[model samples]
Target: MNSHKNASLTPRGREHLVKNIASQGARKAADAAGISTRTAARWKRRYQLEGVAGLRDRSSRPHRSPTRIGSDKTERIEGLRRNQRLGYAQIAERVGVSKSTVGRVCVKAGLAKLPPVQDSVPVRRYEKERPGELLHMDMKKLGCFDQPGHRVTGDRTRNTPRAGWQALHVAIDDHSRVGFSQVLRDETSHSACDFLIAALRYYRKLGVPIQAVMTDNGSAYKSRRFAKLLRRLGIKHKRTRPYTPRTNGKAERFIQTLLREWAYAYRYPSSDVRAAELQPWMQHYNFSRPHSAVSHKPPAFRLGFDGNNVLRNYT
Candidate 1:
């Protein structure tokens, strides 16, 4: 049992009180211990009968609870929760019990929440051996705002008109998680091709030559222009299966980090200011920030560069 902060006695303190009682009578011990004489006498008797073990706190649960729900009803409640995935109200209605009673039964049986549905295909995680062997590419659409949105000002009426949208194109090495991103006007095939070229050039500077690129089956990726650019660069293009975003999970994961760290990280005065911040943030992400995928080392470390060297070259 956990003692409250204001509790006067613990198991050890109780033992000390028992010792005091043996020396000076129970009345005097009770006065010194700041407990009633009855309580002191009870502890003394318990210590004498069971020694140190009796001084420890015991469960306050009663030995018998006549009003407790029966075993049959509890089994029925657990069965309904497990088989039918029923809520407390539904289970109570079907089992002819109060909703609170059903909740208590469910909590006792460890069925307070339902388990996640198991997928038929077991998740198979794989990573490329080299940084450039496979690169994951994806895009996220962000609202271009002139001022802080309702999230900051808490004024829903102060909305910007024709704020438009910016497409955030992201590319990341499957192995190192070294990422590059650009905020473009649209997510068209032409914009995707341009971002790919810029990302390729950036990776080349890091000494990582691109071999293959994996992207979601979007219209931009399916366009002939995007395909032609990849063909011209002699890089293989891999498209994720339709409706399965996890196939391009690295890029998706990178976008989530980017959103949290850079995109919505601060309240920018305007879209241009947020766009200007992207380059410096990307530099930090690639060279300074520790990546969990790369064993808590910066993504640059996976590219065979030490801290001092990376700072000198990239900074």
Candidate 2:
């Protein structure tokens, strides 16, 4: 009979309504439930002044369901949604109904839209406690720059002097979210190892020795030379499962960041041109950019750990 606004009522509202109902039906039971004196008096006043409807929240909706859908039709919409992940348009098409009907049905079913899926336990596995303790590595490829009057430049991957997409090899500290990266022509194993060498040197400049290195199951990381290099450096080597990028999520996130911020930020002329721009961009990212994961602190803050301490963050 009444319209619907926010169907969801709070416990306080429910208690007030329950008390009002009991006062009319069973006053003795309402008093026994320890209904506060102030709340009871207010309920009594609302009932007397505005009657039963005054004690309830007013609905802003229209008085009648003008587009009242049949029970069978609403049930049909929900069935399509649960059986198949059909979108509103698709469901409407299948059910031979209007798009709004499917939307309204979904809302009534309490399955309007799926919430964003974020794992409570962050899949970015911890390798070590400190910044230098463990580092995760990954690679991403971007297109080249776009140049005028050049069809090749029209494509994001075209090679150019100032613009082009290049492979980004990133290394990140698991605990501190400190990141290091290198841009190169290809994602070859040699390139990965070279990036690692440079990353090691970069940390060494800060007096931090990498205790361990972690990477995905890539041929570059699986090379004999890479293994020997790790042994020579006296650092343990760990590889995450194949295709499980989240196991090494820090590096993956760095790649996602690169996509969101630099490569996808603005359009360049060509791949060669875009590739060339990477060095300066990396310099700014590593030294200047403040990371939210590290409390708005730069990665440099986690550098220069004492040899006695192996890890910087643990959890």
Report the number of the highest-TM-score candidate: 1
Cα RMSDs of all predictions? 4.3, 11.9
The ten-residue window of minimal lDDT in model 1 covers 306-315
Residue pair clashes in candidate 1: none
Model 1: residue 298 alpha-carbon error in angstroms = 1.6
Task: Give lDDT: candidate 2, residue 119.
Answer: 45
lDDT of 2 by residue, 1-315 (tens): 353575333435545555655665435434544555556566656777877666676556888886677888888889888767689999998888899878887997887885445546554434466667788888887645445324424654534465544678888777766677777877777787788899998767656778888898888889888888889888899998887777887888888887777766666654566567766776556555787766676565555332233344210
Return the top candidate by lDDT: 1
Assess each prediction's global lDDT (C-alpha) against the native: 0.90, 0.70
lDDT of 1 at 249: 85
